[model samples]
Target: MPKTISFNDNWTFTKTDSPAYSRQTIVQGQPVTLPHTWNDSDGQGGAEAYYRGACWYQKVLTINAEDLSKRIYLEIGAAGNMGEVYINGQLAAESRCGYAMFRAALTPHLKQGDNLLAIKVDNSYNNEVYPLGADFTFYGGLYREVKLLVMDDIHFDVMDNSRDGVYLTQASSGEGVFRLDVRGRLVNEAAASANGRVLVQLKDHEGAVVWEDSQELAVADAAEFELSGSICNPVLWDGIEQPYLYTAEIRAIVQEQIVDTRQIEIGFRTVELTADQGVILNGKPIKINGVCRHQDFGGIGNAITKAHMELDMELIREVGANSIRLAHYQHDDYFYSLCDRYGLLVWAEIPYISFPSTLDPDSRNAFEQLELLIKQAYNHSSIYCWGVQNEITIAVETENTYRIIKELVAEARRLDPSRFVAQANINGVADDSIINTFTDLVGYNLYYGWYYGEIKDLGERLDDFHRTRPDKPVLVSEYGVDTNPNYHSYTPQVQDYTEEYQLLFHHNALETFKARPYVLGGYVWNMFDFGSANRKEGGEVGKNLKGLVTIDRSLKKDAFYLCKAYWSKSPFVHLAGRRFVNRHEQLNDLVVISNLQHIRVYLNGELLTEIKDGQPLNVIKAVRLILGDNHISVEGIDEQGERYTDEIMLRHVLESDSSYIYVKEEKTEHVVNWFERFDLSAPGQIEVKEGYYSIYDTIEQLYRNEAAKAVFLKYFAHVTDNPFFEVTQGVMSIEKMSQLVFYGIPPELLPVINRELNRIAK
Candidate 1:
């Protein structure tokens, strides 16, 4: 189970540089939120604001043992910057890494009364290593979560699970063999002098033991073991369709007594990468249409909920984005689990961004944090690559940062050869000789068109890279220009972060990839706008809106839908009641952003349009196809113009759901006495049919008989998933609508939505 009571919010603060006990002071604390960097109050939310200093946070926790003799533990979900935990007046646990969970046994420090859990956080900007050296912000404070746990010392089990661990590899549709490996550390509190063996067993979903093994342990504390077992007639686990998971239980027996037991989720799948085919999963050659992401969300700042993370994943899935690059650094396990459960491929990385690491124990400690990351995120199948660094050339340009990165990648390979090693793209002719040999897959984070001038033909970049490094697979790790659409600036050059350039950047880059097969994937610079301490755009501080989705997550600029279209994930229609105000050369009734040649569009149960060679979107004069809940279908005809169609259902909302419009109508004004901040851009369109996303499919006939981009008319289907509008307003979040969008109805509607959302949210 996840650690209890996340440790991210509402903690006391102090500025402490050393671990000296006297540095611990009692100060009034501000209600802090996790998933947020500490500088939210400062200008740190901006992409260009630079703020740094040491800080500490304290949380009051109720520590209780299940049994009088059981041990209690204080688990820090993840500490941003650097931090130390103290119970009452004594040291309990300490950690660095803005991401990663660590625990310290608290039984010895707990008193018979209430406890004050103080965590000292040092959030200073280091120009030598990562974040500070990178382009994003390095927010402060203990940013993740902290948990209080109580368990038996002798029988405790730490089952940190995420994506792929070990399970049955299905032979056919549902048959396969099982492989199990259960691992954990055992602590010996009482003198159980006699030695024993830790037994690991694999059980099928039916509760039958498919395999079992035991490892003799002659020690305590951190005793590692391996249990190998295989199950015939295996049940392969998949996501969305046929989501299956096997349970691996571990039992440590000492002197005929069961001392420990734990369970973990395991999926059976294999991943491979090659220069010729890019990525191969389950024996199928696959290309990654991926997006780069940072965990911090808008509105709530960093104090995000599980529902928000799932919504992010759902957005990724909805766009048919098959992969995600955990860009720049390591993120929380919550996001990882969502990716794993959904079978989305991922590239998990460390915060080795921009600059060189602070040498000495600080860097070593960072290395140790990497070990914890491996143990914590090892089993996740979604993570296909372990990224060692991002743009290490900045630090390595002077010092040998690549030397250390090479060692780390080598170590990671030794730790788990099941996945590939990816070195974050570095500039200035990085020691490619070493990286090429050490890295299984090489990635380049080129900002040629962004930081530099616009590269006329981005696809030519693919061709150039292929020609230079033809043997190794290449991925465009970072692309997409920044765009602050709501606010406009008058700049003729593409340097202006306008909505047009943002959309145009993706359009050109994606078109480039469409012509190249050696390229495995390309992730946009980011998925959503995030908070950054070091940012200044339009002369304002706080929150960088470079994301396709705005900081508040209420709006999707033209680029957001453009990306969906170029991804070849058609038949999606959002904001169907409205058409894009701008006319682009590519928009079409049946848009085909691929090299597959001919395409046809249909509407209202009849064929309507076709584009081939270089037919423009306005063959109908304008890209706007008469907005409404119109039936649209698309057929991917072969070069010879033979057809294969896909259908889509869209809901058009011209008038508000209610006739006596609450806000739209200026009637009565309803006393209009409330003043609260709101994220107007969060909800764009909500599609509905028979209450939910009713996807109708048939053999020959397709959706509405024509290709319909769902972005225009399909955001109203599941009022349940978007109930976020009621309490939060706009689209509803799952946590809010869990009850409604289920085998049941959502919560009752609330007036003054976002205000009530904060109330019920508690």
Candidate 2:
């Protein structure tokens, strides 16, 4: 059998790029371990000042005299953006796609005693890369595992696109039997042909063989073989309930001697997406309780350990999530395995996100990355759909852009016909646009409550989409608001970044999704806060606080319990405003969230109210509190008669607490009420003049007219010069545009600019 060794230790890393390397040079560099990134701190510290250039990692390897005759290969789990591997200062292998595994044969370059292995990794701005522009920071390094494999002269092919060489396709063979077709490649590096027998065995979870087969084949340089096996009354890999898994062992035998062996964990299941019934798994309808996740940690950036991934999985499961959308890019392989074991449906994708790149007309990088993503993760049973792109039309939607997206969808289908292809469209894309019809399923990243419209608009908009495209299956891919735990409000509003508002938004969203059977369930925008270097909202810079859990994984916001109350079957009760203790209002609303049906509330040891057959959320409105400190307690009983309780102390203060509010730095004047500064003396003075331009006109219209263009530049030059302007030029009117990117413009000057544009003739 082949031997695999860890190559993650005793590595030296440096931010400097040097053409020469020696023992002294490697010793002089900072000593580091594998799964390391240089941008751990700066990447999360606001301002787009993180390092994004080439860095070098060097390691020394020693080979014994006896192992010189065997074949040696280096396997790299992943590298950010791009990487080049060098052995003894000689280029051996290179990979451009950052999220997939690749391997290089080091047999030819190896000598007896000692060898130097160096890797140059770069995460710089590359227009040719799939993620040309996105919201998350691209932390650069060898952010995954590295290993070395030693095998005999005849073994399974390690150069097959960095896959496991063995591919298994499974299907239901009627009468409770599952059939599996196994295909694999074998290579003989010796100077002659070799005859071998390939043995395949299927083992159950208890390590008992359920199926076995063997095939005899002749190989010259390389050859392929196919074999089939069947299992009777197999246990299905159900989602979350069972999550049963089987193991497959493949061995290459030459003349009655095992040369190489490979083992893989496999599962059998079936998934179907229907327009009317939503997702069906194992002949039963299942609503996808999903959450999207980013790979970075609080301070670790992208160079995270397997323990971190395990903790994330535990947290996600705790929140009663059955599915996870691995957003934008591919994640570590261990995460996929965890999903398989935990039975979490996965939506995996390449990072063909945000703006489409015209620099590469064919979208070659996009296609290549998709190929890598699909081929590398083909065997994992947790992944049900392949996401092609996310918000690609946000910047400019042209014929070329549409063509590239269509091709990507086609490529994804061609690569994995068994899985569904999906895309997440930006909010403004019309329902009838061709982009919505390019995939098997379509998801809209709508933020009605936070970004543009009222919270009630979410269900109405989804209803409109169902009426327009009844044949298409739809999901709400992303929807969230940034929340700061410190900010609290008795009467929450949009963009307040308060825990109360976050709870209100998700409560409404969850109810909306549950009410509509035609619409598939929604995935929360994020499970945890993440680093977005360009974001400066929610009283934090370089971070998007739209997560149920804090970025550091130290705190679970009140909204987390709201989701847990709805989805989890476990009996528990949670007080909604645990952090918002001090309040000025004499009469306040006390909220309780629990999975149990029977709930009771008490104030200062006095029974306040009781609810029987209650829903997940129960609100006791206008409860009068004492002048000083007051005690609130909620108790619930499940069907099993088990008791669950939660308690909190609220101080009824005489004066309002300023610390509960998010105080914005005075920006000359408060821009939020810019429209309030409009002259109301003349009732309808701001009305659009006929055949003339005004704030009501689209940005594209105003930019086309010379007179209106000059007026627009006079007062709003900063808006036109912003990168966001390109994303909204043709799609949004000036009045609506200002609502999104309203900064720097003085509140008092808005009416003057509108009046100036109102004077220009169309």
Could you tell me every candidate's TM-score relative to the true structure?
Answer: 0.70, 0.90
TM-score of predicted model 1?
A: 0.70
Cα deviation of 27 in candidate 1 (Å)? 4.0
Off by over 4 Å in 2: 21-28, 46-48, 668-762
Per-residue lDDT tens digits for candidate 2, residues 446-546, read: 89889778999999999999999999999999988899999999889998899999999999999999999888899998899998765678788778899
Clashes of each: 71, 0
Please tell me which predicted candidate would have the highest TM-score against the true structure: 2
How well does candidate 2 score on lDDT at residue 702? 82
Q: Any idea what lDDT model 1 has? A: 0.57
lDDT of 1 by residue, 1-762 (tens): 223444555666655444543235465545555544556555335343345676666666664444336666666666667667788878777666666677776777776656777777666654333344445555565556666555544543443321222222222232455455455555556654446787777777799887788888765554555555556656555433344666777777777777656666566765667667777766676777888887776545555678878888777776667788987677778888788677777899877655444334135644665566676788665677888777655323332544677678877887666667887564334323556566878777666566654655466656766777778878888776667664322121365665545655777676666667788878877888776654555333565666877766677666676666555433433221122222222233333332234666666678776656532111233343344545666666554545566565433334323211112223232223111123333443333333222221110111233232131123223332421122222112322232222222212222223222222211
What is the Cα-based TM-score of model 2? 0.90
